[model samples]
Target: MSLSGKLETDVELKASAQQFHEVLCSRPHHISNVSPSKIQGVQLHQGEWGKEGSVIICNYIHDGKAKVSKEQVEKIDPVNNSVTYKVIEGDLLNEYKSFKITVQVTPKGTGSVSHWTYEYEKLHPGISHPETLLQFAAELSKEIDSHLTSAK
Candidate 1:
């Protein structure tokens, strides 16, 4: 099946969209509560954070085994409150030809809508669409919202 998914969440727009974008794109590792049990750590590999061409390595557990994946920032648009990252190498390489994930924020009344999109091409028709990935994005959004709510 052609793989694609989009998840959206509404959150306080108090912090500039750029700020949230920076946290998601660069400082994801800074977020402790939102990280999944599978994820052990994340590290910046090359280039500056929140910039195009920057790379990050994510260490994770898959099937009860540790695995590492490399991803590179493909685009950043502060004005649009969007950032896109492309998978460069990792275990995902075995299943998908390519993967690009985009996070976008747009104002909605007093809050903002965070849109997470995943675009990918499965190596085989048997590969299922990433519903869990969308759930992960939703959980992250909830964590961010809760953090902000508690800080206020």
Candidate 2:
């Protein structure tokens, strides 16, 4: 397998795409209240919210264990309904030299579909691939979608 690669998946969701984008880009901290079991908290570590270069620290439960990710907003495209985060610190760095995740949501008739992409460079050949993490992302998307639906 290549040391550096990208993983992409598109999942259809019942939630509005624009609402999902807002939750990710602007009101991420609110996610904890929406899904307390999956997401613990999202705190801005530096810069300002909803802007490129802003760093956010995310705390969540994955694989039944707590994890943390500190990432910087590399880009935010409202027109495309996409947000890109480049992980700079936390548990993920233990296995990857660099990691980036891009999430894009687009309208799909009455609902929406979320596209998740993971780009990473492995720290060593022994390191496993990130299929589980991608699945985790997909599951998180579902949780968010459910939260949005129930908030109505």
Candidate 3:
């Protein structure tokens, strides 16, 4: 099957769209409270955070298991409140020939909409669609919203 997916969530964050974007784009490995399971660490082999062309290595938990992935910042549009990261190495590369994940925020009233998109090219036809990946994004969005709501 063709492995392409998009997941969107409306988050009522007390922060501005830009602020939310900053948090979303921060090195996931360095953030402490972004998820229920804390990120173990991050190693950036090249460039810097939130900048275009930056490469980041993130270690985190998924399904109660630890996983690591290497990603590169493909695009960062602060004006549009969007950042796209392309997976270049790690476990993700084993299943997908290429994968790009994007997070976009659109402000409305007191809250904002967060859209997470995963575009992937499966390495083989037998690979299943990445529905679980989308679900994970939704969960992360919820966590971010809850964190911001309580911080307000």
lDDT rank, highest first? 2, 3, 1
* TM per prediction: 0.80, 0.96, 0.85
Question: In angstroms, how far off is 98's CA in candidate 3?
Answer: 0.5
C-alpha local distance difference test of each model: 0.73, 0.93, 0.75
lDDT of 2 at 104: 97
Lowest lDDT sum, 10 consecutive residues, model 2, at 30-39
Q: Which candidate should be chosen as best, given TM-score against the real structure?
A: 2
| Candidate 1 lDDT tens digits, 1-152 | 34543444444455446557767776777665545664678888998877789999888665567777799989988888888889999987788788888889876665677788888888888877666666656666766655654666
lDDT of 1 at 116: 82
Best by lDDT: 2
Residue range 1-152, candidate 2, lDDT tens digits = 67998999998889889999999998899989877888899999999899999999999898889999999999999998999999999999999999999999999998999999999999988998899889988888898899898878
lDDT tens string, model 3, 37-86? Answer: 74566667788777899898878676667777898989999889999989
Quote the RMSD, in angstroms, for model 1.
3.2
Which prediction has more favorable lDDT, 2 or 3?
A: 2
TM-score winner, 1 or 3: 3
Clashing pairs in 1: none
